[model samples]
Target: MLQRGGAHHRRPRAIERLVGAAKPTASIRALNFASNEMLFLQTCDIPSDITSTEALGWIGFDNTTAAEIFERYIARPDPTINPADLLQYVYGHISRLLTSNLRNLPRVQAMRVVGLNKPIRRALLDPCYDQILWTQDLHFWVKDTLKINYATLMQLQQQLGNYIHQRRSKQKQKPASVHGMSVVPPPAAELRHWQPEHTATVNMIPEDHNLPASHVTVSASPPTIREGHLMLYKGRAATESINQDGPIADDGSISMEVLSTCPGGDFNWTSPAQYWTPEKDVAEQFRRWAEQRCPYSETWLLAIQLSPEFARGLKREELWFSRDWKEYAWYCKKTKQPLSKFNHFWNDPPAGADLMEGHICTGVTTAISRMKVEEIQDRIDEDHVLQVGENETKAKQCVFLSAGAINRLGREMRGKLHIDIYAAIQSQEFSEGLEAIALK
Candidate 1:
């Protein structure tokens, strides 16, 4: 039975099935009706379960057809009708139908408003009309899907108008000065000449061994010299030790203090001369790390972390080595740690499970022959203990468990102990039972 409004409408079950299967055909028909007038009736005839009234209700005539239909509706004037009122009524009804359904909307409205002789078109499109006809069906569609009501739609239209008006106003208000003026600023005023009272001085001293007191002479004229300043010798050479060997300490070992200060006038130059070595050669370290970690069973999970960071560094060495590193490394920058460190293990499945089985499980398993299940299970148990210990020390931390591990534990309890795994785990009894078995 097909229900319409509150009544049961007699409709064949087979027809309903056929209609469901024919939805694509119906959509095509609807599209055709919008573009072609003759195809409209053919579409209307396709649905045998629908009455002519129902079909007509959905069939929206385009503007040309609506105007013609409206004229026909008005010509048979019963004495009670005023022509003006009748025309308005026909226009409103046709316009409402035209706007409501997607199948009939803009195309129909365009055909109708344009089809009305030129005078009618001018009146409908006039700014004086003020009210635009809109379909309740369209209003309902918008309200249901996007929560937009008639009042909101009107507000949006007003906002659009304001935006357009503001843009036009701005366009008209650009500065008139910008139109004719040259863009370049005038040249800066010429700089005034200024000179310092004291000119720069050059001072140099020749080594004692490089000159003889007898040969040196004082002169008022600029001295002829190369590379160093010449000093006027007015007196006998001062008694100074001219040590042939580079200056040395009394103990015969060269003193750092004397070497630095004596040579460069109290300057410490060791810091600038010091060599630097990195804490870790990231490329070499990553290469070795990748060689060791890449072939591991957990490589996929590791690659997820390593690949990105390796890429971010843009180093060929980092890229080559971390390529096989399973964990995503780039995530560490945003997360403040490598993916392996930040991501909860329990939130992800064991790395190799996907390859063996179609899906990853989140609990205990009975299947053990695939690999060293016992060894893996023991490692998982130890990890859980370490996690719990950490959690106890850090009260706010939450521990994550892998789905595969949890699934295996669940299967073990249910199969061996005959316990409901969900209830046991939820009640915290599963851990108690495991403790008992470990102690035994």
Candidate 2:
């Protein structure tokens, strides 16, 4: 033990405690530097200078991030980590950190969380994983199954919470917001004469509450198994098909297994073959619901729910809701797609023709749902798929929009402009609002 340097801090409690923990040993091996963080260590500017490699004692390290964090940490040569001892380091280091500030600890009984069943993978990257970690679901599962103490679980949660917040902050800092018609700016040549009609690009997506970004419905949700190209479960006759009765884009039998109606599910929410008619009882019900939720038109539902960004739009209160294909088809014309695939431009649009009437001018009608969004949240999991119903064999009649379909539409909508409700309003205030926003 060689003690060469000396330090004198006027307020030296923190530094003394950290550097002077051992009475006999001079060269310290491993030490908890939480005190130094909370109160700067007066002993030295750099804390790493106070530790010895042999004393840093190898501990088990479990990485929440798949490779970015776990691999990167382990890969680094400075802090050599042994794979066998990684998990130990994770538990010990996190536990130590949790104890730094406990002035007003909860008076509740101490409950301890033993550990996760599996190594946390894709901590921040995977939505399904994030949901489990953030919610009490995973903690309770670990507690019930492993009988981990409740107190321990709380600390674990705090640790995860702090870590997640840190990652999100870093993520937010790196990406600058993109604002314009296009989600990203076009090349320099195109920018030379950028016009309002030119799609602007925005880098940041508003935080989505209706559907969590991580809850990837496409990857996580069960696939709809199909037997043939044309779906056999064409509940409606060929004549009663969509107004266009266009060529069937897909002809395949849906896997009857995954199509189960939610238990106690209201049949009224079932998909309608055509657009809503105000005279219809269902339409009136929607009207009343809309009348209560927003100050503006309820018929907006018909307009808003058509885009691939329907989920995002809904959460942001951006799109109008549509009840049937008519309103949905009408709204798509506003989107900036070459084919207006969401509208008539697609060869197989539900409506028979292309909507020359671009985005609906403001003061247009919208629909409101009798059901609250919370109700939908209760019925569907983060994956945006309805929970497996009591009867697995029976296929669900119709969904407002299935996970697969939404993913497909979104994939199609990427880089394509749909009508922007916000811009359309400005145009509506003036005559020839449509031409003003259009590409010359």
Candidate 3:
């Protein structure tokens, strides 16, 4: 009776084995995605050398300069560096380029806003850089320079696939490394404490602990501070300012102490600390400091400290949107830094369109929503633009939502929203929408 039972089970056991063998593993899926990306890249007419001055003008880089910069970084190294580390280094390098008044310039500021990753102040002395770089401006730069955007995307994906495959392959050989499991452990919920209110939206914010994680547009928005007499001062000034003017006395000047008088030895500047005042004299002083690349004075630091308060005191229209200000605010909030260190990027017109959104979090949304390609939610997918709706300026504009806001809207709203990213990419609209608004 036992032998007969065993004989009857053989066919079913064979069918089960075949089904299990046919299933794709994580590594296999990654490679398949990477292959498709590589194919798409091969079809593009990527320039080896671009000589068009018109194209070069958009990013402030000449053809030769752009090509050199692109080539220097585009190629894979003999010994590959981790993708995460490379991305971090690139971000820091670009951040260094924004010195002095450059951060306040609309074009540069726009680029910063478009770049992914919120800035975290590492310390007082260390140069603050965001952890990664993901910006549509970079795509424009690559397209203008005639470099391979596709390669970068594919390389990252390929390396990730290899990593996963290697780990999976070694499960039996190195059981100790795997902690005796047949597969690697799932990613830790880094956002567990900070998840959105909705249980369904818990996975909405993609997080992968596994992988390590541009631009040439010259569109000029209005400057945050108009050309005027800027007073640099120490001590307290009324945080409130009327009209477009900051806190200023009747003569358009304010008193501020000298940087040398400050308690900190870290700053080397000896000039009178600048205050947030308007006057030709103060403006000239700012110009001089910016040109000289002088260390920020105590009053300047005070100005930064009080900028948020001053902005809050102003009417909605009086406040100007600045990329640095928003980024700084988000960073301070994330780190639990005091309000004195925070600066806000207020929408001058008091509109949602002007502000950028923060990444989803369980704790809180720090910034406004930004529109990027839906594929950016996960880098594995091929990047392509979606068709803008009849009245919409950009494609799939509804997905970027704050956790709190989405929860309040209720869960039923979730089923109503559908993003057909793959379908969008496959459609003819992808090529037609090259000039679509960049992901903020």
Candidate 4:
């Protein structure tokens, strides 16, 4: 019976040798171990009663069977070995088989060896040696199967760590401010100049009480990705001047010619009669002009331009604009109340409207009127208190002018033209305006 059993095994071994020696095509060599000969093995009449498990038992190989074999091999008198040594042996063997089969190399060759000492030390010789060994085997199998190397695996690990850290850092960051506060970095590329056509209201107010008065608010809504130069203009005078010219020049200069007429000089300059009346009407007229002319222009305004020195002094310096005209108007809204009656009249008022009428008349007069009411509301909502007293005080001291022109003026005047605008404007309007203003 023993000889008969031995003879049966020899028959299978002979068949295996024949199959191994057969000249396989390139495609057949590429076939995986589970696929190439599994069907043929199944088709062969080894035994009708034998299951795959039984067959594996007969052959002394399978998932658990391989581990058992490895354990038995490790349990010799020389079994006093590091678990990683055994793991290295298994990994090396599998890697060799995979490379040899996939590459269609000679039947057998010396396998590539990978050092496990470093990894074993890194794993700290934990009690979960079996789990670690299994994991390493799986890793080696995948690397060998995919034809990758240790260096590639290490690189993948490093990339995975970086990705995880980045995600965690983003999650841990504070949320964006609800008040629309953002700390934007300075633009790195050349920015498109702000266009007047894109203008949106930040505040508005009516020409009512002289105490707190009506105010209209305007703010800039910058694009998601902004580049190039930016300008921010505070006070109605500066803003109106910017609207007339187009978006402020990158260096903050306003060209008198550009202000007088539209680009290409196609549109004739028509100073709206109602716009330049009583000084109280200035704010409303400016709003109307901005709405009519500023929208659709290709320019970008930076909050920094409005007050450069103030922006520089900020803890988180960034260019931004407000967009709360409705809120501002609501805050400024008031019911009719008794007031001291006053009377005034005008004559030959800029070639439009009766001086006694004291009302602005223009194509955009309605928009200006509504904006004036909103501006007063905004101040009332803000409690008529200075939000940034020190910054406001400093900004008042600084003058609004083209940065490039300022530099040029300084160079021409040998830095003698460093006087602030309120002082200069008080002394002489034309000289101060000429000294500071320029066109792109």
RMSD to native for every prediction?
A: 43.2, 27.2, 24.8, 39.2
**lDDT over C-alpha atoms for residue 153 of model 3:** 28
Between 1 and 3, whose lDDT is larger?
3
On TM-score, the leading prediction is: 3
- lDDT string for model 1 (104-146, tens) is 3453354344233333333323432111111012222111111
* lDDT, residue 150, candidate 4: 25
Per-model TM-score versus the true fold:
0.12, 0.15, 0.22, 0.14
* Model 3 clashes, total count: 19
Clashes of each: 30, 62, 19, 48
Question: lDDT by residue for model 2 over 237-293, one digit each (tens)?
Answer: 111111122111122112222222221122112221212111222222333222221
Model 3 misplaced regions, further than 4 Å: 1-43, 46-62, 70-89, 108-152, 155-419, 422-427, 430-440
Give per-residue lDDT, candidate 2, residue 365.
13
Alpha carbon lDDT of each predicted model: 0.21, 0.23, 0.22, 0.23
lDDT against true structure, model 2? 0.23
The residue-by-residue lDDT of candidate 4 on 1-440, one tens digit each, is 00000001122232233333222110011011112221111011121111222222222133464454355445545545544443244444445444434334321121222222222222323332222122122233233222212222222222223323343365454432212433221121211111111111111111100001111111112212224322322211112221122222323232223222111110111221111111212322232222222211111111221134333322221111123322221221211211211111111223211211111112111122235443543432222221222242101112212233233322322111110001111113332343376431
Over 164-235, each residue of candidate 3 has an lDDT whose tens digit, in order, gives 445446553342232222333122222111211111100000011111010011111211332431222222
**What would the TM-score be for candidate 4 when compared with the true structure?**
0.14
- All candidates in order of TM-score, best leading: 3, 2, 4, 1
